[model samples]
Target: MTLFKTVDATELQARKTAAEEQFRGRKSGIDHFAGNDPVTGRPVGGYVEGGIEAVLVKYAEDLIPVYVEYTTKGYTLTSVGVVSINSSTWEIYMNRPAEQVKPLLDAILQKVEDDYIAEIEVYNNAIVDKAVAEQLAMAERREAKELEEATKARRERIESEVRQGLKAPDLTKPKSGKK
Candidate 1:
């Protein structure tokens, strides 16, 4: 039996879309700003004023997922999630029902939104930081691997030359004296 779970997808999608759009209405709730230096806690100037799109592409990459996971339970609406975040203005949108069983859901969702910002602040000063770190680490690893390969190739070339008598003038030196 296929358990066809029922949910108000319109509401869900509305909530989802609202969550994504929430950023646009909000202003600079982010301590620094997206598309700015993560470590230095720099500001993206007027970009935050323009909303998420004003920030760099990388910073906005995972925003949708974060908003989604923060709002939904197995089949119920745990949180409304973000309607939008307007950095330039520093506003947050949590468009939710006012007549639900727990009116606190709105407040709770707001708190969660605050917590989301807090969570991001815990690790970053600006947006795109974690992304930049990951990219840098990956690039470093690749460069290191390439350097290792180059070194290994150089060593092999030297060894081959020595073996073929094109190099090496002290191959007979038994300095360790192991008989």
Candidate 2:
């Protein structure tokens, strides 16, 4: 007892045609940008910009997959993985439906920007802390100088008062036992 009935040849052909048409229609909605080789103007799939070719090559030393993957339920499409790369431009084949690819790319770009901002914030905090420490040290030095000047002035005032009350003690004179 089979669960499915076999269709006629004509009906099967019609079904195949309909499925292809639907796939083509979905593919048509995606935007394609021309990524040319910056040096030769030859059409290329990807490019690595910013003069850091060695570093990128090192990371991509292994195989880079360009195929697309479907979600577990087959309802969503993952990234249109790396298709090609040239000297400074890269292309992602991403044969994804329009709705899926655009938002995914947007989210990825936003994440990168956010991470960059976080790193900058950490660097900025370090600089700010150093400046604050220097300012505190300067303030302490000023306070110490002010205290030293005040103590010197007080000592001079006390000596002057003693001199005015009694004659200056002679350096050569010996002290008497009786008051």
| Whole-model Cα lDDT of every candidate shown, in order | 0.48, 0.50
Per-residue alpha-carbon lDDT of candidate 1 for residues 1-179, written as tens digits (9 for 90 to 100): 52222344465556545754554344323434456667986766443321221221134545555445433521222243333354422212333322331343455446556655565565454445667898999999999999999999999998887877865556578677667
**After superposing candidate 1, which stretches have Cα over 4 Å from the reference?**
1-127, 166-179
Give candidate 1's TM-score.
0.26
Error of 2 at 73 (Å): 11
Best by TM-score: 2
Name the candidate that leads on lDDT: 2
